[model samples]
Target: MNHDTSSEQYILVTGSGQVLAVSDTAQSLIPHISPLLPDLINGAGEDTVLLNGRTYQIHRHLLKSESGESYGLLISLQQTSAVQSSDPRLGAIALALSDKLEINHVLENVVRFAMDLLNADAGALPIYDPDTDRLLPGHLVNLPVDLIVPVIGQRRGLMWQIVHQGSSILIADYADHPAALPELVQVGVRSLLATPIIYGKTPLGILAMYRLRNEPFSESDRELLQAIARQTAIALQNARLYQRAIRNADERFALYQASIEIGATLDLEQLYQVIYRATTRLVSHQRFVIAIPTENRMVEYVHIVTPTGRQAPQQVPLHCGLAGYVLRFGVSLRLSGAQALPEPAVQLLPEIEGELADGSLLAAPLIVGDRIIGALLVWSNHHDAYTMADLNALELLAATVAVALHNAFRFAQIQSQAITDNLTGLANRRHFLQVLHQEMERNRRYHTPVSIAMIDVDHFKQINDTFGHIAGDYVLREIARRCRQQLRDVDVLARYGGEEFGLILPETTYEQALKATERLRTVLATTPIMIDGRQINPTISIGVASFHPTVYPDPSSLIADADRALYLAKQQGRNRVCGVQELTNDAQP
Candidate 1:
């Protein structure tokens, strides 16, 4: 039962409102202030002692230790104030009413009690809008229901100050507070109290009370209002959290429905569009891009869709962009806002038109067959706007989309295989002819030189006759594999028919073709075929033919020229490349 009378002006407690020791003066003043202790503690602002007809504002200080524990102090003012007659039982009644009410119910009663406690003719309880993150006076207890006051941005008034500063404001005279108007005073709100609704030190909102006459709020009234303000904080916190959860759940359900609709698509492009739409709908975004890897460890942006409903056909390289990093790292990259993005990322997306148009971006990797084949980048126009639920849902959708892409690729591969040689795993005769025609057309158009080589395994039929056809087949397969290993990726190797293979080399001349054919013949001669623990020597005869547009204009004629050279090699004891001249000179009628 002690108080600090050094200065009963401000209460700054850093600990949990505990008193360690008191001085003799504090102990002595304790007796005089004990009766009014509850009210003084509950008051919203500066402490004031009422004596005669004058008013004074007293300061109290409270402080919290570094460990977050709080302690209290009391100070007495040099001046004394007059008493403003009000209900003495109002504090106890407000507490009693709030004890029986839940968060919302208690908030309603608190607003009502605020009117009675402060002797206000009208009062209002503003709902804090979580979306706008502002206090909007939409609910009221006594004031006109249509008096909409927005407590956000520039419109932030007394209510905003209390919530933002986490402190209470007591206006003894409305005229003194710059924001107070004569209308508020005329409406019986001569004095005003704005107490912050706080939960665990964080401010949720403010509970404001007003009086009608040219009077100030009592210390006792402030004490009662503070308790009510704390209770209101709890209520608002619960209501806001409940509202957020409901909204998030509803959005998830919508995404779930859209996912089902999109799941029916077997096409990769369609699936990507579906995922993009669902993601943009559930979470706000301006642009979306998908980058898939091409040959040579390079990634190409195959799809780019904007929320503004525009699609671009140009592809982007994944070497210096955020999307590229996502593809390279195979992890999510969440940028806080556009400011957090790297300079290179901003510069690389310059052609994107509209600021790359988003503040937050989420990039997710698409993994299939133990490899990250691509990545999805989604952009949002708000900072830290995406939630854990949004990320989880996107990851699930990404998994599905990856599977769809894999299926599409497999279908394409199957279609390609329809014209491929299954035995030697090379292009079949039909595919070879089609490819030869295409290569010829390309050579003619570009005026690029090309060389064709027709190779035949020497005594292949004799090997099948001596050994079984299975051994012959094994030899053919091994030779095809060697030819593929020697040729560049651009070179085409095809099984022309039984025991015959043809290679179409682009960007090559006659001399290079002859040297390459000789190497092929030597490789087969040196590398022995191991079958059933038996090493069998294999050799090949090759015929080289160089395409000259004027000489061999047609693909069939070019192939025949190479075939005739191969026949000449066979006549001259196979296992050598017979150039075109060898065939013409050796053919004597």
Candidate 2:
């Protein structure tokens, strides 16, 4: 077995399996043969092994001298198959695929590398389409642009066979294969090789290479193509996950920006603008509408923005329209095509009927706690234009909008309570003084005349004693209402104190103030407030005061003068108007 030692490649290894010497022809095979010495020495016969993409036959024999004692093992290495290591292009392609973040770019690189490394004339990367249950062309190299590759399915084309079996296939003669499509044969494809692009247990697509001549693909070619498909699968999966992560980050940022911008203002109009700008970042809409529930159980359109212009606010029943449906159920909705325009929505939202007829719609309830306060509605002019992602983004924005609106409404309520009287719905005493101070400051600066009046319900204590406090409150409320109806829009009316009211008339003289007070007195006296079943006539005594630079320079002095005139009117009789000038002339020494 040891004849012609010069022609055979041999490795000398110690009994413990470490290379001690290698023949001249075996030097190149040392690295591959050294690791297999232990297994060859332990085995009783010759064996074959694969190394560096090449097959080699191993023969192990005891190295003995004249004493017939074993000191080392002589491993005979004989070349079997001529397959070499992976093509250098595979390494470059792996590097290129690692740098790509887009799926299409990765697929293209896979096809190009497979065609160049395998020496194929044409190649294609077809992605699996779950919707069609087929493989669709993703990227093509040296393939006709208009050539339609047949879809991959069970017992179908070469690509389908590879994907279905989860293995690489080498069709040495595509014409002899029963599953070969005519389109491929017509394209002058004589041989083809396909490998399934698998990620984990799932098949993502197929990487296929075609040759125009009858050159059969080698085993190394099949192995290299499969390796490229594996790399391509990993690249594509990574790209898809990276894209999803980016989208999620963008969505979160949009919601955060919307919260900040919308919460920046308490003004209703400015709030609407911020909401619109923030929402446009996530989804574009042809029309935007905000509807809130009214006290009468009706949904009122508080804001509406369309492509043309904003519409006037209108009220609709709570059971009407898509917005109403979301409000009633407290659920989000995404409707497209025919379902976007239901009969109820068409009947209630006639203004937006055209938008709903041919477009898509998304709506989410503005919920605070367990209550559905309102609804946010958006419409687009394209059918099925919105996805679940869009709906989710809108819902996030809706939550922020609802919270902002709630805060603004609460702030308005608190501000109203701070300035208004709870009983009569007029400005309170503190606000009245503030307004008077402002007006007096204006008068002092510009030397302009401003008038003030004090009105008191005559004999209010007597009415409270006779008819009870309830009837007295009724009288006061009615008198305040009637006096308010007599004032101009520029005039300020306030409940100065219990049973007393104050009025500020801008740009009015003493005579004009007297006339206005007289009108308020007559209105109160003429209107009898019916309390419980009795008609009670109420009279108001009014006093007018004018701001003069030399006479009443300060707000307190002006108020004091008005009060003195009111005392004079009350002393004379109720239901009368008296001026400060008349009182001052009477008090002259």
Candidate 3:
């Protein structure tokens, strides 16, 4: 294909390495490049070619689209002098740096490569950790690794000057320089040359070379180091991209499994634990919490876990901390350093014990439809301890949590309809049976006592006949409510049938069950339920049966024992409590 060769030499090829277009200058050298195309496409950099007895350097330039798609390749040629352009080792250094994918390995190799390029006795390339906003002295060649890495913000240093001036520093004798560390001088460092390694606007670190002998570095040495610095920047950036891609793949797989786990869990507390565990896989965090908004403009901490264990959950004002802030406004927050965080979030987290405010905190809102239900928060006790990738992972998990929470609430509503009495708001007979069987099984394992009480209203047919079924229905609902108020929370109360209620008092002895039943009879007989401008007194009789080690074989046999006691109570006197041994206690009717 024909191309614009008037301005410069350019040979454009398709992404598949096939020659597609050529500039006018490139047309004359087509035959020379045909053989080298395969190697050039496979990451080969530059080569020399003889055209008309004159030497030229042909560099491979990868042409990429705006979205980073490999659009094509451009082979550009330029005349090269006999003296050669820059050091040939720079190409080998770049190739070596690019060959490694691990970021730490790439950085370590870059330090040794820098020393080889500048011919220095020692070299150091300290990488910047964004989380701590500090340089880490991880990679060094013959230099002490314990030295605190110099940064641009730390004034009165050689790195600061190099970073600010955007030029290299060549020191002939570094024995008494103010910017030089006394420790370096004591370690036999006499000469030094340094340049900043930057990728775009971000300063990665300073590439420093040290010499034991006092040999001055020339301008050519500085130029060579700068060229290698540029190559180092490209290699570091590419390595980071490769590492990030790998982390993202692992995160996506983890999140996919999290979605399924969260969705299947009907228990809200279990779901919270699942979500918190899932988040730990995707982000580095010392603490994780789930908070929801309470009715009184307060944020309730339902789930809070730290490195030690769970922190006591409590409620705080809506403007108290980051969780409330994220839940209120439905926004994600990544907080670290002095960069402005909201006033309320910056406030010390007194409510969340063992959480330090000095570190970083990231929060994301759990939203379902247009409403923000709650927030998920992760905290680290170090400055700049989180990244954008961590926040993104949190947001994704929040979305999964939101959907799961919504489904759980909906499922609960439907399940309630299946197992709840509409009139009394108590467990229906079916649910009661299930609970009974479960409690019996638990007692078998724990060897705990179990007692069941059955109650029936006396003369209920007469009241329904006189006051109509509506009045009877109202009194039955009131009885259910009163029983629920008096019983322990562990007691399972249910509507057994019309005018009948069943109560399972687990972990209770025979005497304790009888006393509770007696109390129930007193409550119904002593207090008059006001209804329709009339005080209606509805008394009741109760029967108590304790599970025996040998007598009662199962839940069905236990129910039969309780029913026998109920018949005995009715025969002795209504408004009385009776047990399986025919022990009766009378209540004033």
| lDDT score of residue 213 within candidate 1 | 60
Model 1 residue 265 CA deviation (Å) reads: 2.8
- Show how many residue pairs clash in every candidate, following the order shown: 44, 0, 2
* Stronger candidate by TM-score (1 vs 2): 2
- Lowest lDDT sum, 10 consecutive residues, model 1, at 47-56
- Residue-wise lDDT of candidate 2 within 1-589, one digit each (tens)? 2223235678888887677888887776555444345445666665554333334567887888889988888888675533223566655665576566567888877887778788899998888854336677788888886675536335565666677799988889898789887878888999988888887677888888999987889888888887777667766655555455567668889888888899899987788778778878889888888888888878888888888888888888888777777777788878776644544443446574344656888888988899888888888897666777788899988988998999888888898899999999999999898988888888888867789999898999999998999888878788877877878877899999999999999988888888888888877778788888888887889888888767765788888888998999999987899998878663211
TM-score of each: 0.44, 0.56, 0.73
Query: In candidate 3, which residue pairs clash?
Result: 5-24, 131-384
Tens-digit per-residue lDDT, 285-379, candidate 1:
77777778777766677778765675654555657577667776787766654566754443446444225434667777889878887787777
**Pairwise TM-score winner, candidates 1 and 3:** 3
How well does model 2 score by local distance difference test? 0.78
Tens-digit lDDT track for model 3 on 316-403? 8888777877877889988764454675444446448344546788889999989888999888887667888889888988998998
Quote the lDDT for 310 in model 1. 57
Give the runs in model 1 whose Cα sits over 4 Å from its true position: 1-167, 171-192, 200-203, 208-228, 251-255, 297-299, 342-350, 353-358, 368-370, 381-389, 416-589
lDDT of candidates 1 onward, in order: 0.67, 0.78, 0.77
- Which residues of candidate 2, in runs, are more than 4 Å off? 1-243, 261-273, 308-317, 320-322, 341-347, 350-355, 439-451, 482-491, 505-523, 545-552, 564-573, 576-589
